[model samples]
Target: MTEQIPVQPVRQVHLLLVDDHPLVRDGLRARLETIASIRIAGEAGTAEEALAIAASAPVDLILMDINLGTGNGISLTARFKTEYPHIAVIMLSMHEKTEYVNQSIQAGARAYVLKDAPAVEIIEAIDTVIAGGTYFSSGLNRQTASSDAGQLLTQREQSILKCIATGKSNKHIARELGLSVRTVETHRLNIKRKLNIEGQADLIRYALSNVIV
Candidate 1:
C-alpha cells in the first residue's frame, strides 16, 4: 500500500488578543493557551498597541473588543481590514444588538462572538473564522438568519434549519445529510441561538413562519 500523508491544521493560527482590560486579556489568554493549534502572538490594551503588534508579528487573526478605550474596536477593524485584507478579525462584545452586528460586518469582521459565551463557543468561533467561515454569537437578532440581516447563517446552517423545520431528528438529519450527529446537534443549537429562540417549539415555529418549508 502507498504511504498516507498526514493532514495539516489551518496553518498553526497565530492570534492577537486586542482588549483594553488587562484582566480580560489575561483571562482570554489563559483560556486560549490550552489550544495546541493556536498561538497567542500578542496582547494589546489599545488600538495603538494592537496596530504596533500587528505590524511587527506574524498575526493570522485578531480577537478585537468592541470598546477598546480611546480606540473604537469597529474603527480599528475597518482600518486593519482596509490596510491588511489578509488579516481576519472577530469582534468580541457583551451586547448582541443587531446594530453592532451589522456594523461589525460592514467594518470587515468575519465573526462576532460574545464575551460571556462559553469557552467552547469562543473556541468554535475562532476555529470557524480561521477556516474562512463566519461565526456569530448566539442570541443575536434573528434577522441575521436571512439576507435582510446580513445573511449571518452559513449555507450549511440554512440547510440544517430546513431539516429542523421538517421535524427530522438529529440522528435522521445526520444520516440524511451525511453529517455527524454531534455536528447536527451543534448546528441545531446554533440555529436556535441565532434566532434567539429558547425552546425547540419556538425554533420550529420561527422556521416555519419564515417560510423555511
Candidate 2:
C-alpha cells in the first residue's frame, strides 16, 4: 500500500489595489499574485472607484494611495473604514513624514508602506495586517522619543490604546470588546486629546510605548 500525503489548506487574502497609475497597480498586483496565499480581487484607479469596488467586491485588504485624483487618501481611508467597517487598509505613499503617517493611522489604516520600500517589506506588511497586526516602515520605528503633557487618559482609553498598538482599527477593537463603532471613535478622540500626541501617527507611537494589548 502507498502512503498518503496530507494537504494543508491555503489561506487566501482577497486584496484590493487602489492607485492612480495603471502601471503601479499592475506591477503590485503581479508581484502579490505570485504569492499563493494572496489574490488581487480588484483594482481601482481613483479613490471613488476604490470605494465603489469595496462596496461591491469581496475585498479583505486595501493597498491605497495617499494622493488620489484630487482628494487626500487619508480622507478616503476614514470613509472606507466607516462604510465597510471590516476591511483593512494599508496606506501606500512616497512620503514618510510623521504627519502623513499620523493622519493615516487616525483614519484607520492598518499599515503605512513607502512606495520605494523593499518588496519584502510590503509582503511582510500584508502578512502582518492579515494576521491582525499593524506595521510601520522601519524608518518611522527608528525614531525614539517621549514627552509628557496632555489630558489624562481613562482606563478604557488605555485599553483602546493597547488595541491600537496591536494594529487594530476601531471596528476590530469594538468587535473584540463588544463596543459600538461610534463608541470606539469617541474613545479614540479621547485618547488623542489625553495623549497630546499631535496626530494619528503619534498616537500609534504612544500606544506602542505605553500600552501592551
Candidate 3:
C-alpha cells in the first residue's frame, strides 16, 4: 500500500502598484503577471488611494512612482514606513538624479529602478527587495559614482544648495523643506565650510554652478 501526498502551491508575493498613469499601470501589471511568484494585489493612481488600499489589503510590497499626481512618492514612502514598517517599497522613477535616489533611500525605499529600465532589471530589483536587500539600477549607480557632487554632499545639503541656486532666501528654503530658519542657516554654514566658499555671493555662485537643477 502507498500513501499519496498533496503538494502545496508556492505563496505569491502580493504587490501594490501606485502610479498616476493608467497606461503605465496596465503595462506594469502585464509585465509583473508574467512572473509566477508575483501577483498584483491592488493598484492606486494617487497617494490617498494607495493608503486606503494598503489599510484594507495584505500587500507585501509597493511599486510606487516618484510623482503620484500632486503627491510625491518620497514623502509617501516615509509615511508608509512610519505607519507600516513591515511592508517594503520599491521606487520607480524616470529621474536618475543622485539627489532623488538618496532622498528615496533616506525615506525607506528598498529599491530604486528607472522607468526606462528593462523588465529583467525591474524583476531583479523586485526579487532583491523582497529578499531584504537594497537595489539600484546600474545606470543610477554609474551616475552616482561619476558625479563628484553626489559623492560630496548629503541629501539635505544638496536640497539646500538647489534652493540657494534658485535665489530662495533661507526662510523660504526652510519653509519649503519644513525646517527652521536657524537650521537652514546652519546648513548653509556647513555647506560653505565644506565647499570652501567664503561669502554669500560665492556660495550662490557655487550652488548655481554645481547644483543639478
Candidate 4:
C-alpha cells in the first residue's frame, strides 16, 4: 500500500489596516482578500487604536496611512517601532513630498507608497516589507536639489526643534533657550519656511524625525 504525503499549509500574511477612510479600508480589504496568501487580521481608524490592536492581535504587517486623526501615522509608526519592533509597517500615503517620505522612513516604516498607485504595487510593498526589505514608490527614493533636504537652520533653530518635539510652545521654548519671545517667533517662522512644515503637527513630526539637537 502506498502512503499519501500530507501537504504543508502555506502561511498567510496577517495584516493590520490603518486608514481613516472607510471606503479605502473596504477597497483594500476586497483587493487583498482576493489573494489567498494574505489575511486581514485587524483594522483601525486612528493611530492609538491601531497601536492597541497591534498589541492585542497577531499582525505580520501594518498597512498604515500617514494622516490618521489625533495621532499621525508617522508618530504612530515610531511608537510602534519603539514598543513592538518585531512587526513591519508599510506606509500607505498620498504624500509624494520628499519630506513626508523622509519622515516616514525615519519613523521606521519599511515601505511608502502613494495612494493612487496600482493595487499590485501596494501588495508588492507589503510583501517586500514583510520579507525584511525596504520599498519606496517610483520617483520617491531620491531627495531633489530643490527638495526640503536644504532646509538648513542655525544652532538655535536646531535647539528650538528639539523643544518643539517635546511639545513646547514658542514662549516656553524661548524661556528654555533663553531668548526673547520675539526672537523665538522669528526663529519659529524661519524653521517653518526652511523645513516646509505646513502645520504645528508637521513641525513636530519633522523635528522628531530629524532630531538634530
**TM-score to native of every candidate shown:** 0.68, 0.68, 0.66, 0.65
Top model number, lDDT: 3
Worst 10 residues of 4 by lDDT: 141-150
lDDT at position 76, candidate 4:
90
- Candidate 3 lDDT score relative to the true structure: 0.84
Q: Which stretches of candidate 2 lie over 4 Å from their true place?
A: 144-213
TM-score of 1: 0.68
Tell me the TM-score of model 4.
0.65
Candidate 1 per-residue C-alpha lDDT over 81-199 given as tens digits, one digit per residue, 9 for 90 to 100: 98888999999898677777778877898888889888888899888887666777774555643333225555787888778778888899999999999999888776654455577
TM-score for predicted model 3 compared with the true structure: 0.66
Report the number of clashing residue pairs per model. Answer: 0, 1, 0, 0
The CA lDDT of each predicted structure is 0.81, 0.78, 0.84, 0.78
lDDT of 3 by residue, 74-179 (tens): 9999999999898999999999777887778779887778899999999998987787656677656543622455544568988999999999999999999999
Candidate 4: pairs in clash: none
Model 2 RMSD, rounded to 1 decimal: 8.8
Off by over 4 Å in 3: 1-6, 145-213
lDDT of 2 by residue, 9-73 (tens): 79899999988889999889878999999989999988878888887879999999998877778
Residue 192, candidate 4: how far off, in angstroms?
A: 31
